[model samples]
Every structure is written in C-alpha cells, then in structure tokens.
Target: MPYIWLLPAMNKNIVLASTSTLYEGTYLDYLLPTIRELYQGVTEIIFIPYARPGGISHDDYTARATDFFATAGITVRGLHTFDNPATAIRNAAGFFTGGGNTFLLVKQLHTLQLMTALKQAVESGKPYLGTSAGSNIGGVNMQTTNDMPIVYPPSFDTMGLIPFNINPHYQDPIPGTKHMGETRETRIHEFHSQNAIPVVGLREGSWIRVKGNRITLEGALTARIFEQGKTPYELKTGAIIPF
Candidate 1:
C-alpha cells in the first residue's frame, strides 16, 4: 500500500527530518531521494547554518550542505552570502535549515528578524527543509527540544509553521541499562506539565512530511506522540498525523 497521500492543493511543502544523517553513509544520504522529490522545482537553496551542528562555523556547515545538495544537481548558497539575511530568505528558491543548537539558531533568527520572514516564505508556498534543531523550530516553540540552553533567544516561540511541537532524536528507555538519566519520554512528560501543545517524538530514522494541512509520518520507525494528560503513544510508519 502507498504510505503517502498526494495532496496537490497543499500549497506548501516542508520536510522535517529528525536527523541530517542516519547510521552512516553521508549527510542526507538516507533522504536524498525524498529531498529530490520534495524539492522538484527548486534550483537554488538558501542554507541557514546558524544551528552549526558540532559547533562548526557557519561557512563550514554551509559547505557541508552545499556538497550534499550538489548530488541532486541543486545549487546551495548560505544565508550569510547575502548582505541581508531576511532578504535572502524572502528571495530564495527554497530554504534549508541544518541542525545544531536550537537556542543558537533561534537567537540568530530573531536577532536578524528573519524568523518572521521564514514563516512568511513558507506560508507563501516556498518549499522548506529542516533537520534536528531545524525541525524543532518548525513547531510552535523550541521549548520541547532536548538540547540544553546554550543561549537565550528573545522568545521560546518559533515559526509555528506546524501547530504542535517536535522532539527530535527521540529515544526510548533501554531495558537493563544502568544509565540514570531521564528518558526522552520522561522529559516530554515534564514538558506536558506546562504546555498543552502535543509533541511528536521523531526517532532518528523517522520524518514528518508536511503539505499544507496534511502531515504523514515516514521512514521505517514509529514516532512516539505525547499529548497532555494522555499516555505517549506510538505512531507507526505510514500514519497520517492529525496536526
């Protein structure tokens, strides 16, 4: 059976990947095909490297994405390449936000006043792609992120492109393990204590495909969803999320 429902009227396209890399090959190797399909008409992409995964420099991060997208015959230019970040996003053919520290990314976005521009572009029917912290910002706020507060932004609020929150790199409690850290589930429960917005725990291999009002869960794994006052439930692959 087909797992994806083609919605031509969606008017917007977004890819929210839990991680940029999976198990090994290369950055976005696991999702290159999907990326290609989602970004069909896009020729050049505006890369937002503020997240700076591994504390890498923005130029370095942009270089990595440039190399990856080159495989798809698409050109990638960093937002920093332009004199104005907001203008860069507003005029891009497509948008891609790489993963790193969600706080840092949010800070840069708000600092440059590009956050609203990004939301406007996406809502205006531009194709958008995000991974890790990038995907976390697609939600109502970054409060559901698992990353520590390395920096403070003007607000925890994000693009709110999607109605709910996204908990990327979600992991379950390993049985027979001696680790005493709070499991991802526990932390999400704590988030629920204060927020009513539902959170989808996207495992490393899982992704959410957003086309306007419809969202479909993809990949080989099941996503864990946490709702207020309700037990976190597993949403299997091919499930259509009620976002």
Candidate 2:
C-alpha cells in the first residue's frame, strides 16, 4: 500500500529527493529515470536556483540543471530569467529546484513573494522535483533543515507540499570517533521539543515520490523517521510512511 497524506487533496506530482547526486556520481545522473517519469509529456521546466549552493550564480546553477535535463531531452530555463517570476511559474510546464543553502533559498522566495505562487503551481499538479535544500522547502517549515542561518527569510514557513518536514542528506551517528557534535537525531529532537510536525530523515539515493494521492519511499536505503514524542524509527525502501 502507498502512504497517504494526513491532509486531503494532495494530488500533485512531486519528487522530493535527498540529493541531486550520489557519491562518485554525476549531477542528477542517479535520478534521470525518475525525472523522466515525473515530467512525462513535459518538454521544458523552470529551474529554481535560489539555494545557490556554494554561492554559485543563478545562471551557472541553472546551466548545470539544463545540461543534465538536456540528456533527458528536456529544456531548462532559470526562474530568474523571467520578467515576472510568479507569472513564469504559473505558465511553466514543470519545476526543478536544485540543492543549496535552505536559508538563502527561503529568503529569496519569500522576499520575492514567489513562495505562494510556486506552491499554487505545484498544487495544481505541475510536475515538481526538488533535491537537498530544494527538497527541504517541501516540508511544513524550514526549521528542521541542517543548513546554517546565513540569511533570514520573512518566515520559516515553506510550501508544505508534504505534511511533514524533510531533513535531507541525513547522516547517522558514527559508532566511534573523537569528533563530538549533536547528531542529526539530537537536533531533530530539539525541533520536536517545540514543534509537533513529523520529519523524515531522507538518506542519499532515496526520495519521496508523490503521484496523485499516493506517496512512497523510493531508492535503496531506509529512511529515518521522527515524530514529536515517539521514538525514532526507520522505514525501508517502498514503505509507505505513516505520518
């Protein structure tokens, strides 16, 4: 059985991935098949590069996505290139948000007032793909992100395409090491102390795939799951997350 959203009317087409590339892999090469299926019948997509990983320019970031998608026979356009971004989103065939700094991405989206527009477009059933920081925005809020607060957004709020938050590039605790830092689990525990939203610790090579009312975990690895008050657990590949 497929996982169902707690909220109703979640009929959108979306692929919220843990990362765009795997170790020793090319950009988006690991997800080409998934991308092809998600954007079926669509020839072009608007690439949202607001996250700007490593301070890369929008044009350069978009060029990377363009090059990758071109292999799949799809055209790519940067959302920044449009005169009116909101209008561009509304008219877009689909959207692909690449990974980067969540803080910067959210700041730009809210500042430009494009958050709601992008949300509306995706909710309308346009194919949407997100990776890393890009996938973080699909959650209830950006508070669970692992990124540093390099910039401040008007709100920690995000698209909430999924009913829960996503912790992309989630890493497990190293069994033995002198390095001491808060585990991803500890930080998420801190988040749960104040917020009741569930969070999915999406591992690399895995993703949440949503089609119409069904949402399923894809790829080889198991995903860690966290709820506000319950013990953390793992859901294996193809498991329907019961939020």
Candidate 3:
C-alpha cells in the first residue's frame, strides 16, 4: 500500500499553502487561481473555521468565511451540516482548510480521528487544500507552528503531504515589540534546538505549489530553510527540494 499510495501522491491531488486572505481584499491575485487549477475546475469551497485555540466554536468562524467567499461570487459553505465527516469530504470536489491556530486545528483533527478519514480522501486522488494553519497540517508535524500546542494532536504526524515544516507569517525579528515570552529570533532558535526538522519560512503573500514532485515557489523572493547545526540557506526559484 505504501508504493500504491506513492503513485497518487506524486500525481495531482493536494494543495497546501499559507493563507492569502487579506482582511478587506480577496485572495484571487494570490490564492484562488491555484485552487481552481488543483480542483480541475472552479469549485464551491467549504470552510472549517475553528479558531481560539482548543475552545473555539465553529459558528462565527463559519459566518466570516461564508462572507469571504460570497464576495468572490463563489458558492461557499461550512463543513458542518453533515454529521458524517467522511461523507462531507467524499462528496466535495475539493477540500480547503483555512488558517488560524495550527495547534488548535491539529488538536481537533486528532480528537476527532479525522486525520485517518482526511488522509483517505487525499490518497484517493481527491484535492486537499490547506491555508496557514491548514498548510501547517500538511507537513510531517506541526512542531514549527507559532501557536502553542496547548492541546495535544492525534499524532505529531501531520498529513505528511509535505516533508518540511511551515512557519507562516515569517516576519524578521522585530526590534522593540515583545509580546510572546521570547523574541522572534529566540523562539525560532529554540525550535531549532529541539528538532532537526527543516522549516520553510513563508511570508504572508508567498506560497508553494505541489504539482507531482515539482515543488515550485510562488509569489515572491525565495524560501528560507532553517535547520540545526547549519547556517540558514536560501532556496530560490526553480529549486526542487527532496523534502
């Protein structure tokens, strides 16, 4: 089944990326076209909005997402009406995950055992798209998420659709603002100390498109790869990393 899964894995199936959702603007110039291509058509997208880290209810999130899609004139709905989640993912032309707190998303995914069900959908050649926290779940694990893992995941095992970790909102070290316990550089350095996992720093407007092993960088500049014991290196346009 491993090799059997590899074929579809290498074929066109999933779209995992950070959120291009600017508050007042649409993601068309940044996000929608790639989704349209992945689904093989313009699809009526579904939003799963569970923010607030382990204590979120899906209502307000859903309402906000509905409004976002409605503005673009695409029929969008929340993945809540159906009690049977397998049925929910199975019936859809494509699945999109909106970003919030990745730790929260993973906690819910584990608690519900939706990981198995969602993985089944991806393996069957269905398109799966994740944004921000959504994209974080595509990696080997969510260890790199800026959010604290207040709730444990089903597994550190992410969707494994991608080999690297994603650090969305990849801002350079802030000079004077200190809100979280550690400085930006200190936090990332701590992450490096704990794991050797390669992390990809994605700026707000940037993303990567995985179309059958052709992992291409989009939006602007290049992706920064950070690892333990080694100096961070920059991978520019047309670089195909094994991870």
Candidate 4:
C-alpha cells in the first residue's frame, strides 16, 4: 500500500542526489567516497546514463558512461537498452544516475516502462545514487526538474524511491543570465496549485537522504522545504522533514 518501497535503515541503503550539470560535476569526488563509507562500501557501481535525451546518440552515451566509471575502479556497465532495463538495474551492486535533463530521463524511463523497475531496484537494499537529473527523479514527481519536455516520455512515473519531490540545483535567487527559467520555489508553487505534495529544494553540492524514517541533509549550507500554505523553511543537518 506504500507509494514507495524503501528498505529500512537495517539494509544500509542510501541515495546521493546531484542536480547540477554533469560536465560541471566536480563534487563527485566529495560524494562518491562518502557513498563508499555507507555500510562500509559496495562491490560495483552501475551507471544509468539515459538522461541526455536526443542531444546525443545512445552509443555515445553508453561509451561515455563506461569510461567514467572506469576511473573509479568500480566495474561499470551501461543499461540504456530498453529491452532489459530492470535486469541490469536489479543486478547492480549500486546505481548512479548522472546529471543531464530530468524531463528527458523521466520520459524515456516511462516510455520504456522502466520507471517502476528503476524504483524497485534502488529500493531493494542496494545503494542507489543520482546526480542532477538523476537526482530529480528520486522524488515523487518530476515537476522539480529544470529540463524541458522536448520528448514525449512514457510516464510521469520516476523512480519515486524518495517521498518528497526533489528540485535539484535549487536556488533561492537566480544569479546571472535570465533565459526565463522557473525558480524551484516557483515550480513547487505551481505544482502545489494542483497537487498537495511536499517538495525539497536541494541545491548543488547538497542532498536529502533517507534511511528508514530518518532523513538527513548533507553537503553545503542547508535545504529548504516548501508546501502550500506555509512559507518555505530552511533546514540544516539532522532535521526531520514532514514529507
């Protein structure tokens, strides 16, 4: 009856979210090592490099992912083939979703009917990690994502392993160029105009992680939680979110 299937803290499973562009992902060095410490360590890391959409060809995508994991000393495999997404996911000692376009990633997974499978695999007592777009899908819905809906993804069904919707790259104020982007606060407000779901604004270099009922905030500064009537509130480490 649970919308999400998360193994308790006893399993030692966790998720690391990155909402920044992968090309600018310098924080991996900081996060990956901590992921290794969770439950001591993991055997292998399976990379799900499927968020690029049509920006790049599948072969190129796969090749790029294969090479990235090579440096980590963790055996890596690309699971972009739609025919058997769940198979590859289930076999992973742990999962990492690289940053890209969350909308594209969600659409592809839904279209291929792999969203549920990805969700299942991550919650199956193994470490499931996501960066940028990869991290966005961990939440209940994809509205927090910044990617445009260029392609017709299969469904809105993302991994949904995490309860609160995640707005990766979340920032209170937009700094420089304005190409007309939606703020995390604005988007969540929009999402709430219809749905009453709680949302977490996770800035770059930060993550919201849950182990059993205890959710912890990591990385820089703090995270913000937003709901309909209430004003967005700031949270530091060790804070328990109502979501």
lDDT digits (tens) for residues 144-240 of candidate 4: 6777777776566566666678777777775785758666677788888988778888776777676755668877668888887788899885566
| Cα lDDT listed for each candidate | 0.89, 0.92, 0.69, 0.69
TM-score of each: 0.94, 0.96, 0.82, 0.83
- Per-residue alpha-carbon lDDT of model 2 for 1-243, expressed as tens digits? 354443334558999999999999989999989998999999999999999999999999999999999999999999999999999999998999999999999999999999999998898889999999989998889998889999878999999998999999999987896788898899999999999999999999999998867778999999999998999999999988786
Model 1 residue runs over 4 Å out of place are 1-9
lDDT leader? 2
Local distance difference test, candidate 2: 0.92
Enumerate residue pairs that collide in model 3. Answer: none
- Candidate 3's residue-wise lDDT over 1-243, tens digit each? 679757876765666665547457665346666655676653476666644424556766666666655555556667765697667766766666777788778777777677767776666666777778888887878877777666666677777776778877776767676666665456667888888777888766677777766676676557677777777767785567546
lDDT (0-100) at residue 119 of candidate 4? 71
True-vs-predicted CA distance for residue 127, candidate 4, Å:
1.0
Better of 2 and 4 by TM-score: 2
Instruction: Please report the candidate that would top TM-score against the real structure.
Output: 2
lDDT of 1: 0.89
Descending-TM-score candidate ranking = 2, 1, 4, 3
